[model samples]
Target chain A: MKELRWGLLAAGTIAAEFAAGVDESKHGVLEAVAARSGDRAAEFASRFEVPKCYGSYEDLLADPDVDAVYISTPHPLHGAWAIRAAEAGKHILCEKPLTVSVSEAEKVIEAARANDVFLMEAFMYRLHPQIRRLAELISSGAIGEVRAVDVAFSYNFATPRLTDPALGGGGIFDVGCYCTSLARLVSQAATGQDVVEPEEVLGMARLDENGVDEVAFGLLRLPGGVLAQLACGFQLTQDDHIRVYGSQGQLYVPKPAWIHEMRKPKTSQIILTPEGGEPEVIEVEATQGLFAREADHVAAHLADRQAPELTWAETLANLRTLERWRAAVAR
Target chain B: MKELRWGLLAAGTIAAEFAAGVDESKHGVLEAVAARSGDRAAEFASRFEVPKCYGSYEDLLADPDVDAVYISTPHPLHGAWAIRAAEAGKHILCEKPLTVSVSEAEKVIEAARANDVFLMEAFMYRLHPQIRRLAELISSGAIGEVRAVDVAFSYNFATPRLTDPALGGGGIFDVGCYCTSLARLVSQAATGQDVVEPEEVLGMARLDENGVDEVAFGLLRLPGGVLAQLACGFQLTQDDHIRVYGSQGQLYVPKPAWIHEMRKPKTSQIILTPEGGEPEVIEVEATQGLFAREADHVAAHLADRQAPELTWAETLANLRTLERWRAAVAR
Candidate 1:
């Protein structure tokens, strides 16, 4: 079996984390890294034990040894790098939210289609098995018909890195996107339809001095009359969890939002407390068991020339919702 | 001191609970009861050991022994009964939500002011020691500068009463209003503002079969970059809780929403969880507990020709928010 060769477009924290995820994946290998400076790229490459390093994203994408490229850059650079990687005919695993704006996300989609490259948004939590188990439970009507979904992903990001707007920082994009995505994912799974965008949006955002949204909150209306209340902020501390309620009982996944360490990973659990029952923690062997499984699924899909488990259509819908939310808050 | 002569208009669950709350109070008494039928009224009066019973709302307001009337009827009747009670020179203690519509709430406010009666929304939760404690902690900068507030009040009201729009029932109005009101209360307390309203409104709601909101969720933006995410629903089950986050620490009041059982009333606990610190639960005893405190405040205000602890101005601001939320969902 040929290992999927990975290339990273940035050598920052996110890029390093993703490279680590790929490195730890049984079916994938982190082969190359790129940064703005040759010295920085070489440093990142040496630290991660990658073989190749490039001074720029274009140079990394040109490497024939790279079968896939992960665009892990700041907000303004995501769309451009993703389009370039697509044009280079590399399967792209771009970090979420895919771009700074919906139009930019659309352009990335167009570029991927034009280049006939496999493209997927790197919402790693979706690939995690606990969420899949939740989806399965919800689809099977474990909670009967789902009535509402609530999610929050907030953390105190007073670190100057987040305080700066140029870094594509602030709460909404940094952490709020998780709550937004989780809410949509749960609502879609519950209703068995694409998330229906709210007819109107009412938002309250707290802004920092830089005019970036420090804390952003949103509500989404789904078809079949299900409401989703979502809160995300870099300025607050949240449990990084999601809850879905149905006619029968409610299922809660506490701290379900996580980016596992490449090493020393452990199984996560989903706590199910039916109305009249005590809480039962179902240990989810998601990291060691499921990441490899997800990688295998991606590899099989690539080999078979089929789309992965999550379709581009679903990804587009998710991005559209996030865009709508951002627009609502921007106003 | 004279007893607070009280009358309740409705013998439903809330009225029964509230009657018990009044009887348990050290300085109040339930003097009258009213229901749609004379038999039900008489039954409730006898059960609660009240002195008077009336077949109709007008008959109860005509009772000279009743100094104040608590309007505990269905949403559609709140405005009419409150207005009539005010005209009859009776102070009013309405339910959590002042009235069904913004205009109706306005009418209640006008009548209360015009008739010089102490009228206050029966948001008994507001008088909770825990809520007051939370306000105090936030004011004292225990959480540093307050930045975000999140609250949810949801339960599976999928059955008959909540799904009926004709009953003025739905998630948003029935309980979602609590989420909104809680968010507003937290925001006001944190910002040190007498009133707080979101600058931009964005909401998404799931409509029930009867076209009333089954689940409604929204965001509120306050001055100084404060953001609030709120959810209230009849379709989903969630803990009735509120969380406030600031720069230094976080304040959480677990189960703040429905702590209104008049008998087994539990005090809301304030848990301050700072970064890298163990959570400490702050137990606070109010000078007067919820229903009783509000009752005493109203009685004192009426007796001394002073304003109640909570003012109609706040009620009007809250109504404006409700109107905006309704309009956003309507769109």
Candidate 2:
């Protein structure tokens, strides 16, 4: 298969990480990078050893050598840039959350479908091998019909852009998206559905002076009587834990964020406790960085026209849930 | 202090445990045992080595030597027995749920107040030293203004009596009450209030053919934007874990049930994770069984008129929260 050429849409922190991941991937190459300033784009190109640098996203997208674009811009800018990339006939891997609201997500998805381009939300942690194994265990009925899921993703983050409502900043959009997505993923894995929608959603938030939620809690009732509890905040320190309880037993994953998988190979531990038995720890090694695996996954879709791990319908469902949660909390 | 004489009401499993704990206490003595049948009372007395046995609950309450009674009857019968014991001028330690509903709890409390007798719910887990230490840490702002609590108390309980709907057998009355009570306890500790009431509650459940909930989930919005997630079931195997997340850090107790503390001395572990720091495990050793601690606590209240660890107002608040949860799920 021909190697898929990549273009970095922003020279931000995440963009640098993606460039390194692209360099490490076996089926992808970094063709060009773009930033608002030419000097910043040239510096990123020099650091990642890319062949070309463009001062603007449009210039990079128009380059014939770039086959796909990775959008790492701020949350509010994702939809506009992604639609532009789709119009330029480039496949897109946009960072999470895909957009700030459900309507924006809908527009991005429609643009991708109309332009006949592949698009996936960059939820890199879902591409980790440990997550796949966990999903397999749930699908195999290791925990016998999941009844409830408890997820928490929190950190004491402080930044102007992160706390600014104008920048689409808040715990829900920043980190809570992971908790919601994982809940949906596990629900689908348990019930064998391509996508599962929450029947009911209740949410509470502690908002800052800037009208951004510093802390948020959400409860969702999924189909088949499955319940999920999610917590995300910028003011508390959570260990990034995820627990799924079922009729027969339960499984817990500490450090579900897979932080080490971003920069280097690492191992993750999953604790499985069966009814009337002791807890067993299962360790899974990811030999490749999560970003590289994600890149390869996108490459497979580009090469064979295979469906990406995250489907468009599922993305829309998740965004809608987020919108409902925000609405509930606002009331 | 003089030894407080005790009477065992209803020769059930919990009655036997309470009898043993009374025997182990330095300030309590088991004076009599009571059951509907004289033979059953005598059998329980022989097993626990009590001196006297009575055929009916009234006869045991009439005994002059029985200064306090431990009520261990089924859920639907607790209020009646406790009120009767209070009228007989005996201090009462009733098994948890306290009663099946909030109104019943109110009547029991009123009866005890009218008779000028001490009444305390036998939530033995609360008497464990680890729980006390955890409360102290929260009060000391170890976690800094508690924001959310995640609690689960589940087991595969399968007794005919436990599954009988007419007997008020269900996860909410049986196990979910613990989650609600703990949430309140931590909330009070955080806010330095004698009791805390949830502003809003939402619940969902999976009920069996008997119309008894086998699994239940609840979300509560407490004062000051604090939120709590609780899960309880008779169908799942949860290790009874409790996690409290706060502004500065979080704490997790692995074995929150502390059921084993009823008979044997044990050590419980609490993990405290400060913001941007490693988690530290704090171990607390219970020199005496939790039931013994409970017995001593009652003895202190009887001898010096000391207040019990769980107050009547707090118990009522917890029951009201449980009632709201049940009502929400029923809808």
lDDT per residue (tens digit) for residues A17-79 in model 1: 666666667788888999999999999999989999999888998999999887878777888
lDDT of each candidate versus the true structure: 0.74, 0.85
lDDT of 2 by residue, B1-331 (tens): 8989999999998888888898899899999999989999999999999999999999999998999999988889999999999999989989888998889899999998889898888877877888889889999999887888888888875787768988888898888998898888888788888789998887877778877888888888787556788888888776678989887788999887456456888887899988767899999888988788889989887743325568887788888998898887774
Q: For every candidate, what share of the true interface contacts is present?
A: 0.91, 0.56
Per-model DockQ against the true two-chain complex:
0.64, 0.55
Per-residue error (Å), model 2, residue B211? 3.7
Best candidate according to TM-score: 2
As a whole number from 0 to 100, the lDDT of residue A218 in candidate 2 is: 86
Q: What is the RMSD, in Å, between candidate 2 and the native fold over all Cα?
A: 2.2
Docking class of 1: medium
Please give, for residues A1-331, the per-residue lDDT of candidate 2 as tens digits.
6899999999999999888899889899999999999999999999999999999999999999998999999999999999999999999999988998889899998998888888999888887888888889899999888888888887887678779988888888888888889998888889888888998888877778877888888888887567888888787676688888887788999878446458787888889998667899999898888888888889988743224568887788888988888777774
Q: For residues B100-214, could you state the per-residue lDDT of candidate 1 as single tens digits? A: 7878888888888789887887777666666767777877789888787777787765756677777677777677666667777777777788777777666677764557776
Q: DockQ of candidate 1?
A: 0.64
